[model samples]
Target: MIGDIHGCAKALRSMIQELAPTKEDELIFLGDYVDRGPDSRDVVEQLIDLQSVCKVIPLRGNHEWMLQSVVSRGMDDSMWLRSGGRATVTSYGGSVRKIPEEHMAFFESLLACYQTESEIFVHAMYDPSCEVATQDDELTYWTHLPPSLPAPHHSGKRVFVGHTPQPDGEVLRQSHLVCMDTYCFGGGYLSAMDLETETVLQVDRHGHVRRVPVERFAMLLKGCVHWFRSRDS
Candidate 1:
């Protein structure tokens, strides 16, 4: 599974080359494919191309919701543009109105959530009090799960989420819940994880690939904590 791309198309392409999954291998993108970077158009275009070769499930993120609001509800562009929407607009040749019909459809057709017996793939959060079928799109696309929510959630499925960017810039796993959004647009790496093997590969904006082991992740976390503490001191 891949984390929130946030418009780093080059990094996404480089990671895809590294993984080199065959036609039988399924790729699940956690969404937020656009915004905050320069290549939102390229990002979506590459994803569209990938669908012809492999199974790709793209879930909707809060940014996509914002885009939907602007495109469908006639919501003011300012709301979306203020939150990295401008970059998307620029990617489309400096006009949101000029965004292609196909790209708009791509955003509109994003799934709210995807589930297998072992894991639930979602862009943001899920309601622990209700079944997925009973949950609303609002919760699926917008809700950021709080720290108090138990892992495995209410469905007893390991949940993989991507809306929350980790401060340590590493994949955050708490019990069965995993968050892979590593703040790629904010001077961090774009991450991917092999769900079956628990292996993680990350590529930065500069195309530097780093394989993260459990111990490496622990050290990254410790460094982030110490950096914060030193700043506070």
Candidate 2:
């Protein structure tokens, strides 16, 4: 599974090349695929191409939700642009007048959440009190994980999320929940984790691979808590 891409197409391509995944290796993307970086257009294009050959599970992040609202509900672009939609607009030849039909379809088709017997993948936090089937957009896309969350959700499935950036540029794990968004658009790395093996591979914006002890990822909750507090303060 990979983290929030945020339009870092080069880093995304680099990670995909390094993984060299076959059809049997399902790629679950944790969302925020567009906005904030230079090539939202090309990023989504590559993802669409990858989908034709490999199994890909794409979730809806808050950014995608904003775009979807603007396009489908006739919401204004000001909010989206304020939140980095300008880069996305620029990606499509400096116009927010229209986005390709295919890209709109891609955004519309994204799931709120996906799950297996042992784990759940969401773009953001999930309400532990509700069944995964009953989760809504507020919980699935807009909510960031609080630093106080120290354990897995009540369902016991390992929950994986994105949206919140990790200051240390590492995958943050707390009990059974993990956050993989390392803020690739903010000069951080794009992270991909192999669930079956618990291995993580990261690629920076320049396409350089970065290796860190996988064990350290399991202890990232401390760093995450610190970062969260600092940001909020």
Candidate 3:
């Protein structure tokens, strides 16, 4: 599971080179491939290219949902612009002259959820006990939260998630959730978790690779920085 990139295509490409997974390796993208920064469309193109070489299971992120809304309903561009969508628009060469055909399909093919042998991975929250059937509903796929606050997840059937950015990592063991949205787009590092070995390797935009030990996954999840309302705090 990688963090919420928000359209850092350069960072993503660099991380992919650093990780250097072979054709035998399977990669599960936790979604939100577009929005926030530049190169969302490029990221989609890269995702499409990667589809040919490896098993790329891309999950739908909130930003992806927003893009879908824009594509499906011709919704106002303000929602995405509020959250770095402008940068994404610029990444496709700021092309207002003519809408490209390939770009249309790139936005259209975003998936809702990805299921593994024993795990369920998505862009946002995941509840191990919720019987999350892989399907087409955006509500369930893009924004479903657990009924209760998820507990520290270390269950055998893990659920890898993004969207909720944290400085450290956030783990819900009882809920079987592991949050990887480490704010890479907000000057944090891009992250990647090895499913076979349960190891996590991360790199910043500048190309510093840091590997997380298996034991640390549970502990480092505590580094998440969740800031709420000023008055409430």
Candidate 4:
């Protein structure tokens, strides 16, 4: 499972190759596939293509909610204002007003509230008792979070989530729940989790690779854009 891709396909593609998923293995995405990164468009295209080749599971993040708001409510909602939404609009050449309503609808359809099968997964939900089970229940998924995480997560089926970016890529916060956003779109590392073993793997925009122990990623991995600038200077 992976979290909050946020359009970092360069890092994502590298991480996926390293995992070397097999036909039987699944590649589930925790959502937030767009916004705050240069490759939001590319990420959507990749997900579309992956539908044929892999078990690509997508959950809706707040970013996806923003796109929905743009479609259903006309970008008047704050979902598209905060949470790095402006950067995303600017990345699309700063004329968000001109972007077609139909295109926004396409983005909304790709997001989900939760996808579960023995393990509960979402973009940023952890309330074991949450009634937010469907796409319409999406508001709760983003607004509410449990103060305490349930233990022996297999009992809760190991809640995998993203949206909270820790200093590092993955935080083994309570053994069962893993926060894997890793802020890849912010030039942080992209993270992946091996569900069966509960182990983590990661790869950044640079040529670095790591297996779990993702605490140092934010400090160690600078933005690739920064790397490009340094080379030019």
User: What would the TM-scores of all predictions be?
Assistant: 0.87, 0.88, 0.75, 0.73
Whichever of 2 and 4 has more lDDT, that candidate is: 2
The lDDT for every candidate, in the order shown, is 0.86, 0.87, 0.66, 0.66
Model 1 lDDT tens row, 133-201 = 558877777777686765467767888988888867888887778989998888788999998888888
lDDT of prediction 1: 0.86
Candidate order (TM-score): 2, 1, 3, 4
Candidate 2, residue 201: how far the Cα is off, in Å:
0.4
lDDT of 3 by residue, 1-233 (tens): 56677777877888788777668778888777777765677677777887777777677677776766765668887876787767776876674223266666665776666666788776766444455554335544455454565654343666777776665533323346667776677777677877676666766554555555444655655444333344357
lDDT of 2 at 111: 89
| lDDT for position 42 in model 2 | 88
Model 2: ten consecutive residues of lowest lDDT: 210-219
TM-score of 3: 0.75
Q: How far is candidate 3 from the true structure (C-alpha RMSD, Å)?
A: 9.6
Question: How many clashing pairs per prediction, in order?
Answer: 0, 0, 11, 1
Per-residue lDDT tens digits of candidate 4, residues 79-194?
57576667667656676665555556556666464546666676775545554354344443474344554444324566667877765555545646667778676656787878
Runs in model 1 with CA error above 4 Å? 149-151, 212-233
Off by over 4 Å in 4: 77-79, 96-106, 114-117, 131-140, 144-155, 211-233
In the range 85-203, model 2's lDDT, one tens digit per residue, is 98999998887556889988898899888999999999988777787668777878788878787355788999999998998898897668899999888988899989987788989
